[model samples]
Target: MSETQNFIILGGSGAGLGVAHSFLKHIEPELRKLGKKYHLYIIDSSSHFFWNTGSPRSVVSAALLPAEKLFAPIADGFKSYDSSLYTVIHGTAVSWDVGGRTVTVELANDQNTQTTLPYYALVLATGTRTPSPATSLHGDHTITKAAIEDLNKKFASAVSVIVSGGGPTGVEVAGEAGHFLNGSAGWFSSRPSNPKAKVTLVTNRDKLLPVLSKPRALTAEIYLNQVGVDVVYNVSVVSSTTDADGKTTVHLSNGEQWTADVYIPAWGITPNSSYAPADLKNDQGYIKTNHATLRAEAAGPRVYVAGDVGDYSRGGFHNLYATIPVIVANIKRDLLEAATSSDGSDSQPNEPDRLFTPNNSETQAVPIGPRGVGAVNGWGLPSFLIWLVKGRDYMIRNVSATVNGNMV
Candidate 1:
C-alpha cells in the first residue's frame, strides 16, 4: 500500500459535509483497490451545523421552534464511521499553499496561533457570510443562539422593525415577524400579542424576487401583505446605525430615513473565500470553478470547490448538491490516475459521468409566516403545497438526515 492520502475539506456546512461524507463513503474502497490508504479531515470553526433554513421563524418566536432544533453536532453525523477514518477539526482555514498542498487553519482555541496540514486533495466549501451578525450563524451555533435571543428581546416590546433586502431571508423574516407581532397564529398561538407592532421589508430591487418574472415574483409580495408585512421596494439602505439605547435608524435610497426599534439586514452574501488563491478567484473574490468538473484550475493539483464559495453557479442549494459528486469523483479519479506521477501534479481531471451543469431556471420554496410561496421551472407552486413541503416545520426533521449525508 502507498502512503496514506490526506483529504482536507474546508468548511463543514451543507456543501462541505456533503463532499466530505460522500468522499469518505466511497473513496476508501476505491483507494484500497489501487493499493492506497486515505484519511479525511473535516475543518470548520463551528462544532455544530445550524439548521439555518428555519431561522426566519426560529428568530421570531422560539415557542414556534426551539433553539435545539436548529443545531446538531456535525461530528455525530459520522458516528457510524471508524474513528481512524477521519478527524474533525474545529478551526477556520486562513490560507492555503496550493503548491505545497498545505492549508493554514486558525484553530478555535484560546491560543492565538495557526496550524498547517498537508493534503493530497483540498475541497473549498466555506460558503458565504451575511454582513449582519443576527442574520447568519458564524463561529458556533451557541453564539448565534445568543444573538437571536438578544434580538428577540429587543423586538419583543417594540412597535416597529425594518428588514433590508427582498431576498428569501429578508422576505421570510419580515413575514414571520409580522405574523407574530400582529398576533397571527402560525404553528403555535402562545406568542404574546402586540397587534400594534409594525414589521416592514425594504428591498433595493423593483420586484420582490428579481430572479423570477413579474407575476411569479409578485406572489411573494402578495403573500407578505396577507401576513401584515409592509413591503417597500426600489429602495436601498444607505446606512444603518444602532444607538446605545438599542434603537436603530436607517437611511434609504429615496433620501428617506426610518427609525425602528429593531433593524435586520439580510441584504447580500459575501463568499467566504479569503483563504483561496487569487489566481483561482473571480472578480467577486469567489473561487472560479470549472462548471462541469468543480475543479480550481489555477489552484494546481487536487483543489476542488463546492457550494456558494464557487463562481460556477449563481449560488443555491440544488447547485451545491449537484457539484458535490463532481468534486468527489474528480478527486478520486485524479488520485487514481496520479498514483504514478513523479510529483503531486494536476491530471486535469474531467469525469464525463460526474459533470455538473448548473440549473438556470428559477426554483425555490419560500415560506411567508407559516404559509409560503414558490416557483419551479416557470410554474408557480400552491401556497398549501409550499406549506406542506417546506413551511410546515422548515424541514427541521431532516436536519439529522442532512447532517448524516442521507439527503446528499
Candidate 2:
C-alpha cells in the first residue's frame, strides 16, 4: 500500500541478507497479526548475493563449482515474499539526510542519475570493503567472476605465488593453492624439480590466526607448512611491482624483496559508512551502535546497524549472527509501538527499546587443503572436525540455503 511504512535496507551481503531474511521470517508475521502494512526496500550495489565465507576457496579453486553458485541473484532469497512489499534496487547510496529521512542513491550505469528514496526506518548493513577472495565490494559479479578466472589462469602458470595477510582469508588461500598445486599426486610433488608454484604466506603478525590461542595458531602454521606453504611471519608486503613478463617483485617492510608470479592481498578492512551520519560513526568510519540494542547512538529517527560496518570490538560472521536477531527484535518493537501510537487521540507513551547483548564468544575454522584446524570459544578442535564442519565445501551449501530463504 502507498501509505505503508517504508523500511529501507542498505547492503545485500551476509549481514544485509541476514536482516532481510529475518524481516520476512519474523517481522512480517508480527506485522500481519497487528493488521499493519510495510514495505522492505533492499538497495545494494551488487545484484547478486555473494557468499563471503566461501569466496577465498572459490576463487582459488573454481573447479569446485560453477561461477553462478558463488554469486546468486538477491531476489532469489525472497521468493516467498509478496512482490509488492519487497523491492530490490541495484545502486550505490551516495548521500543521506537523517533530518529529512531521505537517502539519495546513485544508480549503477553511464547515466548515474541520483534517485532519492524516503524511509520511515533504516537498517545500515553496508558492512566493510575488502579485496576479492575475502569479500567483493564493487557489487559487480561479472567483473568479480572475470577477475577470478584471470587469477586461476595466473595460478596455473605462476612459479612463485605470494599471498599477503595471515588472516583467515590469506591462510585459506595459501592452503587452497598448496592443495591445488601439491596435493596427493600433485604437480609439485609429482615432478619434484619441474619448478612448480612455490606458495608463500606473508603476515605482519607474529603468528597465523592471531585472534586464536597460541596452540591453535601454532597448529595452523604447522598444518599449512605440512602442505608445502612457506609461512613467513612478522613481515608485511610494503609494495609490489609486476614486470612486463608477469613477474612480480614484492618488497616487504623489512627491506627484503622477493619475486613472485602472482600476488594476492587477502587482508585489511575498509568500512563502508560513507552514507551514514557523521555523528553516528566512530573514528574509523564505522557506525556506532548501542551494544545491547544494536541501535545507532543518535537522537533523530531510529536507526540500526549490523555486520562489518558496525563498530564492534571484534568482527566476524559470528558477531553478525549474534546481532541479527537483536536488530530484528528492536525493529519489530518500534514498528508495533508506532502502529499502536497512531490510534491514540492525545498522546501515547513511548515503549522502551529492546537492548541486544552480543555474545563475545568466538569460533573459527580454517582449512588448508583437505585437513585444517579450528577453535570453538577457547577450546581447540580436531582437524577432522574442521574439515567436516567447513572444509568439505567451505559451508557454501549451507550459506546458499540461507540466501535462498531456506530454514537451514
Candidate 3:
C-alpha cells in the first residue's frame, strides 16, 4: 500500500459534501499524525451547493434569500483546506464499477470530457432527481435556478396557481406562496400590496402530508384552509400543456381540466443511480444500503451509500446526520486500522460502535405557511415549534456550515 490514497465523493449536494466534510474535518488530522495523506474528490452535476431547504421560501421571494445565499460555490466552500487535499469535479458520474474501484464521469461543459477516476473509497450520494419544477433534488442546478426564476414570474402574474403533488415539497411551496403573495409573508413584499395569490395543492392521497398521522395531517389541511390555499385530495396531475401565453392547462386523472398561470409538479422521482453498479440497487432503483454500515456490500470494499439515494431508510433531513456519521466512522475506523497496522491491511474492530440501526420511527417537520407539523420518534410536536424549527427561516442560516463541513 502507498502512503497516499484517493477518496471520491459522488454527488456534492447535501449528503455528498457532508461526507467529504465529515471525513476531511475529522480524519485529516488523524492521518497527519501518522504522516499519511489522501486526496478527496467531490463530483456533482452542479458547481454550486444549493440550499434547497430554503427553496419553498426562495421561490416565493428572492429578496428574502438571494441567489447568492441559495447557491454556494462548491469549490470555494473547501478553499480553506489544503489545495492538494481535494478536487471538486463539476460533472456527473455516468457509470461506475465497484469491482474495478473506478467511476466514469462526464464533464458538464461544451468540451464534453469523460474521465475515469480510481478511488480507494467511493461514496454514492447522487440522491434522487425530480422533474423540472421541483428543483430540490435536480442534478442540473443551473437549469433549476433558471426554471425557478421563470416559475416565480409565472406565479407573480397568476392569481390562481396549481401546486401538484401533496408531498412535503408541494405542500410547502403552496404554503409559502399562500403565506407571502397573499399577504407578503406577513412582513413586506415588493409584490402588489394585495397579490391575493390563489394556490391549490393537489395530491393523490386522501390528506395532506401523507407522512404525518391522520390527525396531524388534518392540522396541516386546516392551516392551508385558514390561509385560503385549497387542498385537492385523491387527484393526480395526469398531464399538462403550456400555451404561448404561459397559461398551463393541467389535466387530472379524473378527466377534470384546470387552467392556471403556473403549474408546479413535485411528484415523480428518478433515483440518480444509473452510474452505480446494478447489484447495488433495489427493484425501485434506489441503492440498497446496509442500515448498520451504510455500505452496498455488493460493491465490494470501501464503497458506501448515503442520503436519499440509499434505501436503508426514508430520506429525511435528520437521516443524513444519522447515516453519514456511521459511514464516516466506518471509514475512519478502517483508515485508522491500516495506519496503525504493521502492514497496510485492515485490522477489523469487533465492536459495532460505527453502525447505525434504522428503525420505523418518524422524525420530520413540514411547515405550511407560518404554522407547521412535526414528529420525532412517533411523538407529535406542537405547530408553533415546527414553525419555529423550519417555517421562520427554512434553515437558510445553516447552509454555509453544512457546505463547509461544520454541520454534517
Candidate 4:
C-alpha cells in the first residue's frame, strides 16, 4: 500500500454520500497531522442523486425538483478541501478484482470506456435497486421507475387501476395514484375528457401498515379509505396475466379474478449485491459485515461495507442513520496510524467494545401521502405533527440546501 491511501466508494446514494461526509469530517485532520493526503473517489452511474423519500411523491405528481436541486455535485462539494484529493466518476461497477485490489467500472459515455481503480480501501455503500415486478408473485410492481411510468401511462388512459402490496411503498403508490386519478379530470378538462379512474389497494396482511401498531395501522387504513382507495386485506395473488386488449387480470388464491387497465406491484426491495464478491455475501446475497467495525466478514483488512448493501442481521433498513457513522469510524482508524515506536509498539488501537444491535428507540417514520406515520420501536403513531416535521416537504429542500450550500 502507498503512504497516501486511496479510498474508492461505490454507489452515490444516501449511504454513499453520508459515508463521504463522515470521512471528510472524521479522517481529514488525522491525515493532515500525518503529513499524508487521502484521496476519495465515488462511483455512481447516475449524474443525479434521488432522495428515496421523494421517489413516491415524484411518481405521483411528476413534481420532483431536478437532481441539481436535490444534491450538490460531488466534485464541487469536495473541492474546498482539495479538488485533486476527491473525484466523482459516472460509471457502473461491473466487477471487482479482490485479489488485485481493483474494481472495473464501465463509464456511462457512448465510448463504453472502462477503467480499473486501485484502492487501498473500498467502501461498498451501494444501496438496493428496485426489484423486477414481472416475477413478483405478491403483486409488488409499483416501486420501480418502469412500473411507475407504466402505471401513469395506463392511468392516464384507463378507467380503473389496481395496486397490490400493503407496505409503505405500496400504500404510498396507491394513494398517489388515487390522487392523480382524481386530479386528472381537472388537468385535462380542456382536452378530450377521459373516463374517471378508480384505484383499489389489495394486501394479504390483515391491516395496512401491519408493521405499525394497531392504532396507527387503523389510522392509515382510515386515511386511505377517505382518499377513495378501496383497501382489501387477507387476499393473495395466485397468478397474473394480460389479455389481448392490454388489460391485466389477476387471479386470487381465494378463486377470484379482477381485471384492471393497470396493475402495480409494490412489494419491497432486495439489496443490490450482484457486484459484490460471493464469499463476502450471505445466503440472500447481501454483503456480510461486522456491525461494530463495518468490516467485510471475508475481508482480512482495510475493506468495509456500509448501507443497504450490508447485512447486519438486524434488519434491512441499514441506511444513513445506522451504518454511515460506523463506516466513517472504521475508515478513519485505518487511514490514521502512528509509526512503530522504538520499543516495538503494537499499532492497532484497543478495539472499543460496542453493541451492534439497533436500539428499541430506533424507528423509521414513514409518511402516507402528505400525512406521516411515526414509528418508534416498530410501533406507529398517528400524528400529523410527524408529517409536518419531516414528511410534508419530503426533506428535499433541506437536503438540497445542505448539499448545494444554499437555503431552500
Q: Which numbered prediction scores highest in TM-score against the true structure?
A: 1
Give the clashing pairs for model 3. Answer: 180-185
Residue 16, model 3: lDDT of: 88
Error of 1 at 272 (Å): 0.8
Kindly list the per-residue Cα lDDT of model 1 for residues 9-76, writing each as its tens digit.
99888888988888777877777776778889999888988777888877776787766788889899
lDDT of 2 by residue, 67-168 (tens): 556778888778777888789988888888887989888887734588899888888889776765334656566777777777777877666788999999
Model 3 lDDT, full chain set: 0.80
Please write out the lDDT profile of model 3 over residues 1-408, one tens digit for every residue: 246788899998788888998877898788878877789999998888887778877776676555556788889889888888899988889988777789999998843789998888889988887665435746667776877787767766678888888778888888887776675333342233454767789999898776778888887777776566888899999999999999999999999999988788888677888887677788889888787888887887778888888887676777777787888899888777767778545456555547887645756799888788879988999889988978888888887887887786
Candidate 3: Cα lDDT at 208: 74
| Per-candidate local distance difference test | 0.80, 0.76, 0.80, 0.64
Using all chains and alpha carbons, the TM-scores for the candidates as numbered come to 0.93, 0.91, 0.92, 0.80
How much is the lDDT of residue 326 in candidate 3? Answer: 89
User: In model 4, which regions exceed 4 Å deviation?
Assistant: 1-3, 63-76, 110-112, 132-158, 182-196, 236-257, 313-319, 338-347, 351-357, 360-362, 377-382, 401-408
